[model samples]
Target: MMRNVAILGASGYTGAELVRLIAGHRGLRIAALSADRKAGMRMGEVFPHLRHLDLPPLVRIDEIDMGAIDLVFCALPHATSQAVIASLPRDMKIVDLSADFRLRDAAEYRRWYGQPHAAPELQAEAVYGLTEFYRDEIRAARLVAGTGCNAATGQYALRPLIAAGLIDLDEIVMDLKCGVSGAGRSLKENLLHAELSEGWHPYAVGGIHRHLGEFDQEFSALAGRPVEVQFTPHLVPGNRGILATCYVRGAAGDIHAALAGAYADEPFVLTLPMGEVPSTRHVRGSNYCHLGVVEDRRAGRAIVVAALDNLTKGSSGQALQNANLMLSLEETEGLTMAPLFP
Candidate 1:
């Protein structure tokens, strides 16, 4: 049976990516697409790359017919999805690609995002949308909150090691480089071509990045105690991808074994061989995460690296994967395309 789906905020980067992936999906049909400012515009007009697809014209959220849709992919900006999702039909299944509901604690959301959650009740109900770790819960959840692209990249490198007690809980650091598209399609002075081109620098310095809330919440839950990783994210001049290098105090061989064993069966996460690292170029433009481990000269230290297209595996692609599981369709449907390589 074909499932009718909608993409809210369909004019943004993640929204456009969702449309591109769903265009190739067999089980899902695009029923409605919403974009407040771009309402009434053809999707192709907003994203010329997606013009080739036969898709619904953009409309206001209220203009969408809820009764005709089976699922929704809420790609709205951070801090905005709470109210919009709260207004949607209560019984509807949704996958949100925003930070609104990823943290289970409303207070934590407020601390990180600087405002009260508009829908605390719904916040408590949302399952974290790291599809591989929460597959069963996502399969049963009415709402699934997508992780930050930086957070997802870090987690793929560290989650299994943390769970298996292979890495030091007290000493962990992650330095990440992300493509500009991860900032969304919105206009900002710093994101202009003249400003961002030919250079790279870190943002959300210190312990301030909002995705830290997710890292703290999830890593703590996995280890049964508090685990805080020093995380810094750098914006690269390129178009789309994330590379996270995690430094940890652990034997290199054990870290590799634990990660390999953990993701051996996961369809979207690939664990590369020992001493070989992954490149963002390898996983660009697809729903895949490539992980690699390397030994540091310091005997007790190791470097674990992860790479993926932040727009795809880290955000929109991850959203579609959760949507597939929620609807009881094949988990890899529309998501198995091999990572785009040069």
Candidate 2:
């Protein structure tokens, strides 16, 4: 009873990560892979690390026979997935790793992305794929929009406090640092080794980052009112991982207790002891997310930090987690592997 799945845009970092994770999965099989430009080439050619696995050759989206596929993981770029997904079979289950369907409001999509949504109907149906918070909706959803990496990291640190009214909603601030892989495999002058190595600076300053749209949408829905957090992301030199440091107005002990209580049963989210901090290196190359809370020097202030692999728990690994629930498989299956460490 192995469910056959396909990875669209198989040439990117997230797509390769999916192949790696699925290679260990017992309930799923890689039936096809699509890479418009890399079609007819082997996945190994595009990603040497994945060369060991016996995987299908890359093909164009039109070449894949959807009738044999049970699920599709869309890792295509933001504006591209809308058209590609609309062309797929209506009944196919999809876990999109792109930002296309993450926002519920089409108007918000246009405002953030600067274009009208190409598939409004699909946008309306996509369940926000923050696996832990939207489990039931994701389980029943035919299409699930994976949360943004930065958004996911910040939420893991603050969602419980927001939900429990333990923190001041108006004073939330998140400063995140992520590796370059989150930028994808696309060639960019700024990403060149000479430019990126030995240097790191913040971009999308002043809450202009696209992931903020996701934060506004999700946090607002949780608070039952408009909730806008000051969020800024920086591109660090590492190859993988995201570390989000969120500052909020609340008691540090209560923040720790709330997070520990919230994720006490979650297999992948580990809430550390009070005052300890999480680092991206510890959670690298795994689906796990480590969270910690610390008291600020000033009273009534707290610092919460969360760390996770951007390519895993932030994207592909999360996609797999949601797909597991969608496919009725064990939620932790293929995702419980220990985080890679030195």
Which sections of candidate 1 miss by over 4 Å?
none
lDDT of 1 by residue, 1-342 (tens): 999999999999999898989998999999999998889999999899988888989999999999999999999998899999999989999999999999999899999999999999999999999999999999999999999999999999999999999989999999999999988888899999999999997999999999999999999999999999999999999999999999999999999999999999999999999999999999988999999999999999999999999999999999999999999999899988877768
Error of 1 at 244 (Å): 0.3
Q: Taking the candidates one at a time, how many backbone clashes does each contain?
A: 0, 0
What is candidate 1's local distance difference test score? 0.94
Across 89-158, the per-residue lDDT of candidate 2 in tens digits comes to: 9999999999999999999999999999999999999999999999999999999999999999999998
Task: Indicate the residue-level lDDT of 50 in model 2.
Answer: 86
- Cα lDDT computed for each candidate against the true fold: 0.94, 0.95
TM-score of 2: 0.99
TM-score, predicted candidate 1 vs. hidden true structure: 0.99
The local lDDT score (0 to 100) that residue 299 gets in candidate 2 is 98
